[model samples]
Target: MVVFFFVVGLEVRQEFAHGALRDSSRARLAAIAGVAGVAVPALVYVLVVGASGGEGLRGWGAVVGTDTAFMLGALAIVGPRLSGQLRVFLLTLTVVDDFLAVSIIGVFYSDEIRPVPLLVALGCLVALWLVGRSRQWSAAPYVGIVIVLWLATLSSGIHASLTGMIAGLLIPAYPTQRHKVVAARQLFRDFWQSPSASSARAVGRGLSKGVSVNERLHEYLRLPTALLVVPIFALANAGVDLGGGVVADSLGSPVTWGLIAGLVLGKLLGIGIATLLAVRMGAGRLPEGVGMGSVFGGAALSGIGFTVSLLVISLAFDSSSDLGRQATLGVLVAMVLATVLGWSIFKVAARRWGEETADLPMTLDSPVDPEVDHIRGPEDARLTLVEFVDFECEYCAHATGSWEDLHGRFGDDLRYVVRHLPHHPHGPLAARAAEAAAKQGMFWPWLDFVFTRQHALEREDLIGYAAELGLDVEAFIEDLDSDEVAARVQRDIASAEASGAKMTPTFFVDGCRMVGSYDARPLTEMLESSRRGGRTQAAKA
Candidate 1:
């Protein structure tokens, strides 16, 4: 159970770091919707079970959260085009709302409080927080503090799983570091030449340091936790017996019906209305590709309050007690109904609004120019991929490795374009340097060189690198500092902002912006889906 929650924590941490939550505008919209999602569910739970008195109201927190794993898995199955924005909203809401639900319930419902252990746990949390803020290289400190924190929390009256989640949250998340990749590969080369124990250990150490610890643990534990721990936990908790007429008794109980109403109907109303209200009131705009119909469909699916609901049930009532059993039945029923409701809403949305799953603002602000932009593959290709990048950005560097294969998949049918987005302090210099290389007809080669050697970006280094690229050094220097080159970089920056690109390596597949994972599989899927859509439109014409 602790392991499952830890994985959940890692997921939320990643989202905040590099995923959709990083965009404040996008996140704020989801956050506003999330607030209403929580409130309305509780309000519904109270209304349905209020007749049962104060004890029943305590179960309100149980309805406020949903199962993240189930919610996302179901979303993948839905597979609607241009629905990445919906993914972001649900992810932000679930992660934030779950934490609030658990923390609040833990505070309000625990039987006995242990201040000493809690204070010790608090100290560890503060330490972990500090470590996350620093540019720490090793995972040793994180692992050590988290273990101690877990033990202290176990002894405390507070739920220990909450500590696991907090520890995961406190760990920093970042995209792959290019320098570290190079260093790790070099270490492996050293080991290959001398296969001794010392060198082997060095290789292991290097590999661990190649990526941020937050990502390392998440990748390592995701499989086992998902396949084993979460499933086993679910089976253990969710497997209920009704052979002894317990179902008959539960049907008569307000707790059972209250949970159902709160999860299914309440979630749909709360999320859908809240998002609409927020957008209408000018608090935030919905993502472009997303529609209200899709939002409602997504909201309906948010009612699968599995793990947290079970945890809350235990916290609020004795597991063997009648109210607890009744609450359990309600949760199970809501899961079934939510799935049905989601499917129904999505179907209706598809028919009425031409919206299948979700939304995102994806149209490229500037059209591709074969003569002006650096391109790989045919300009008249059916698929267009545009990347907004800064040469100094490591994430952009990391992404270059995938482009060759991506272009290979579509051959002349896809054109890959790279545009400048000077999103960093050193980005402008790198862009100007690349523009200088363009003057020597070596723009593409210069990009490959500067990305690997981003650490050396001074004027002297740029000139030196330009010479290595077989360019006129003086001409390169002249162009590097030219007002014309600066203007070219500035133009790209303006286009990137106008296109709503908030980070380097933002991708547009067929003019629709792709968010979240930019790996080959997801990128390929988006490209293919868009290609098919384009063909269908053309055929209809």
Candidate 2:
């Protein structure tokens, strides 16, 4: 469990560094929704079980988590029809929910607090942080330290699994040094070009330093944790006996019904209603390609509280007691109902909205070609916003407002370029249409048109839009399938792949890659920080 949670921590770190949560503005909605989701379920548990006035009411935390593993596995059943935005939302929410659950356990469920061992654990964490900062290259030291930390934490009355989270967060999330990475790459190339054991060893060490520790751990542990550790955990914890008339008796108990209500109805209402309210109240907008129905379905899936719920049950009730058995039954029923309900809703949503071809996840080393790309600001600008976007993607459309604000505020200080990564079926056509319009010197306006009416970017619609823009319709139609235009869009796709973009509107500010936040203030702040860094480096030079 400790190893599993450590891996979870690693995943969270990676997400914050390079994935959807990098954009805090967009991530805020999901965080808020997660809070509401947890809050509602807890409230339901308290209300329903507390009304009956028994020890069974203590397991409120049981309804708070969506099994990260199960939720995703169920999501996979929906296949390519699942939008990237929904994926981001659910992933973000689950991670946050887990963190909250852990906090609750530490605060509310611990047996007895031990200050001495806890302080030792804290000291170990501090030492680990210090060692990591000083560039410790070997994993052996970390392994030994981790064992000691686990023992300390275990004896300290905190859940021992928390060491995983501590270790994962402490692991470096960035490369050691750019110069070392460059030198290591060169050496690795040297060894590959002319092989030898000595050079091979050097290259290995160099490559190790080139990647962050968290990333290495994540790569090493992801499969084992998912395939082996989590399953074993489920097998041990998920077995609940429904025989001996226990089911019938549990049916009448508030504890059993409360778990069902909290896990099924409370989670759905909390996440779904909170998201809807957030968007409607202008606190935040929903992610593109995600509709209310999809959000509701995803929220339903969030109710599938399996492993974590079981943990809470064990903590809240004596395992051999009637209350414990009843709560156990409730968790099982809730899991079954939530799975069925979520799957049914998502299947309906998939049919209504249609599946979009998802973008392949790529690395961040993709080449940028500002020279051949469409530019919207001065060439000599200090900050550049390189956006890899799908014309029909609603998130991209939402970002247009931010881009406009950026352009208005920064003017020539910021250079903007749009790159096409058409993953959807209609996406290639839309990209070519925009390219065709670019030939007619109406690329920006045509882009505005396509984004404004993103759902109507088909072949016929593209031609109509071109004609509406007063372009030579014949030339525009011919250019739509032109080899040159097709190649250009493909080039952008290639660049996008190289850059590790798995979703629309992947933005890069001064070569720093970020995904999905369209808030003007943060965008501006990032731009300013980049500009300052550049100026500082120039002055030093």
Candidate 3:
């Protein structure tokens, strides 16, 4: 169990450090839902079981967790529309959900708590934290200290599995600095130039040091933990005998029904209601490819609590007891029910939504102007969006919010072409700086950085960004003022003039020009229209 949770801990660290949870705005909805999912289920358990004023009231923790592994597997069974951002949202939610469950166990389920060993465990954690923040890269010392912490925690009467969570949190997540990476690359280049065994070893060591310890541990432990540790725990714990009168006894138990109501009804109401209120109140918007019905479906699916619930069950009731058997039975039954209910709801809702939106109007026009050069998209894309943008244009800067969404949502289906107008005083310099960054395969990032800090696109700012991106600072400065790059910017301006775009942030969907700044929804609709039109053409052919 400790080993299995250790792997789960590593994943949690990974997400917070570099994955979807890194963006608070994106993960906010999920975090809310997870908390609600836990809180509301416990409330429902209390309502249903607390009414009896018996041992059934002890089972509140049984419904506070979602088995992420089971939920993701069930999502796969349901189909692809359940993927993308919604999947990310759910994954993050489960991470939070499971963390809460573990914490609950540590706080509420432990026996014979000892302050001294617990404090020692905490001190070990602090040591790990300090080592993580320091320049130390070796894993041996961290491992030894963590083992001692685990033993100390075990002696302290805390759930030993918590050591995994603590250790995982302390693992370093960020990569080495850009300068270090660049220096390593330089060393490797030098080594290649000279071709010695020692230089090759140095290069290898440098390269290895560039990656974070968290990522390194994750890569090593993920497969073993999943295949061996988790399965072993499941095999050991999931063997509840349902023979003879055990089923009947379980059915008759209030504890069983409490678990059921909490898992099935409580989760559904909690997640669904909370999500609707959040979205309505502007606390959060639904993830992409998800609607109200999908939310309800996901809420239903969130009831599929297995592994974590089992741990909670063990803590809540002795395994040899009738209450424990009943709770386990309820968990198994709830998982099946949740899977079926959620799957059915999602499929019907997705189908209805798809049919409703199937006839979205076609906004297709001619192919993009091949003469204009700056582009980002797949070569064989059927649709293109061209932007005639000025670096200092406020509208253009605001318009990036929509463009970013379009780029992410449409990906390779819609090609994005950038053309410079250079209308503002600093526009020419910004455009030239972008062109120079393009020489170093960093045009898009440079463009994003420029817009993000549009007011700070001075020469020094451009030079600073160049240095930040590990570009040849001298070459970038030279190119920023060169006649060739200047001509390129002028040519794009001329092309925009030929297209009759007088504004700063003019856009063309293919060749059907749309002037001024727009929102993501309309742009999304246009892209969808263009895509459908292409498919229609193919069908005719």
Q: Give lDDT tens digits, candidate 1, residues 53-88.
A: 867777888898888888877776663654566776
TM-score of each: 0.79, 0.67, 0.69
* Predicted candidate 2 versus true structure: per-residue lDDT over 1-541, tens digit per residue: 7887788777777777776677776678878898998999999988998977867768888888778888877766742453556777788877777777776766777778799999999988998899889878767677778888999998999887666676777876763454676689799899989999999999988888777777887888889988998889778766667788888889899988989999999999999999899888877766555677778888888888887888788778854467778888888888778878877777676677753423233224454455577987788787788788887665562334778888888888888888888877788898999998998889888887778777677788888988788999999988987999999888888777666665676777766665446467766776776777853332112
Model 2: lDDT of residue 447: 81
After superposing all C-alphas onto the true structure, candidate 1 shows an RMSD in angstroms of 5.4
In candidate 1, list every pair of residues with a backbone clash. 289-359, 289-360, 290-359, 362-513
lDDT of each: 0.81, 0.78, 0.76
Best by TM-score: 1
lDDT, residue 363, candidate 1? 59
By summed lDDT, the worst window of 10 consecutive residues in model 2 runs over 355-364
Give the range of the ten consecutive residues with the poorest summed lDDT in model 3: 355-364
lDDT at 33, model 2: 90
- The full ranking of all candidates by TM-score, starting with the best, is 1, 3, 2
Report the lDDT of model 2 for residue 216.
Answer: 82
Task: Please tell me which predicted candidate would have the highest lDDT against the true structure.
Answer: 1
